[model samples]
Target: MELIESYNSISESDLLIIEEKIGYQLPVEYKLFLLQHNGGRPVLDGVRYENEHFDFVGHFYAIRGEMYHDDLLRQIEEYKDMIPKGYLPIGESPGGDVFCISLKEPTEGALFHWDHEQANYDGEPWEYNMTKLSPSLTVFLEELCVGE
Candidate 1:
């Protein structure tokens, strides 16, 4: 996938610090991606899943940057309670939906789309709000297509 407007490159150590703070190890390919691209807008921004659902990625959150809205750490903290455990918000859609990665087993490394409108913040099970997007971040990037 092609990415543009990426932030300043970050070191593996920076990722390690984030992992420690988040209390979960990031997937291997995702870690490499952060080191190389940090975060940026994908040229082929459209993502499709569940046969018909579609959305365009706005921007991926970055690790080393002054853009607070696009800061990975800040996004994580902001969505901690909103997002269910065992997942981490890494980016967003223009309409405020979040893209997250599964951090625990049985679904580790998997990517998901979290629909904010359908989210449950009242301690109800959130499985209904999460739609599996891809088996892993690697596949997710490869599958991104140009939006019409």
Candidate 2:
């Protein structure tokens, strides 16, 4: 789980691509993941290692399901000071209001998925594998112009 820089580098076009893919505009923080990625893979919390079994990239897309999510969301905001430096905070999902974040490519959406059916004390990072990418989402992202 290699913790890359915050997504401050994700381009505006790229951000839009993401929003279009997921069917929603991303919170400012989620947009960061796109930018700071710096052409490398993104990792969890702060770990980075190779996972041959999976793409590690695009592993997660469009997360769903959760419990006591509001409290966790509040906790993240309340304890923002406690969070380590370099740890970027994505935002709560509009559909389910669930906390959502994603891994950069190569880990496309890895860190967020590896562990499922359990809360990660961090909004339960989730993944949507490449194979599972929704046709609509694929079309949306594919068609949307990153505008270079």
Q: Give the clash count for each candidate.
A: 0, 23
Which 10 residues in a row give candidate 2 its minimum summed lDDT? Answer: 129-138
Kindly provide the TM-score of model 2 when superposed on the true structure, using C-alpha atoms. Answer: 0.27
| Local distance difference test scores for all models | 0.88, 0.31
Alpha-carbon TM-score of each model against the true structure: 0.92, 0.27
Q: Which lDDT tens digits does candidate 2 get at residues 35-123? A: 54422323421212231232223222222212333222333444344333222233321222222232333423311322222333455
Count of backbone collisions in candidate 1? 0
Candidate 1 lDDT trough over 10 residues, lowest sum:
64-73
Model 1: residues with Cα > 4 Å off, grouped in runs? 65-67
Candidate 1: tens digits of C-alpha lDDT, residues 22-133 = 7778789788989889999999999987655489899998996435789998998888888888888889999999999998888999999999999887885476889889
Give the per-residue Cα lDDT of candidate 1 at 37: 94
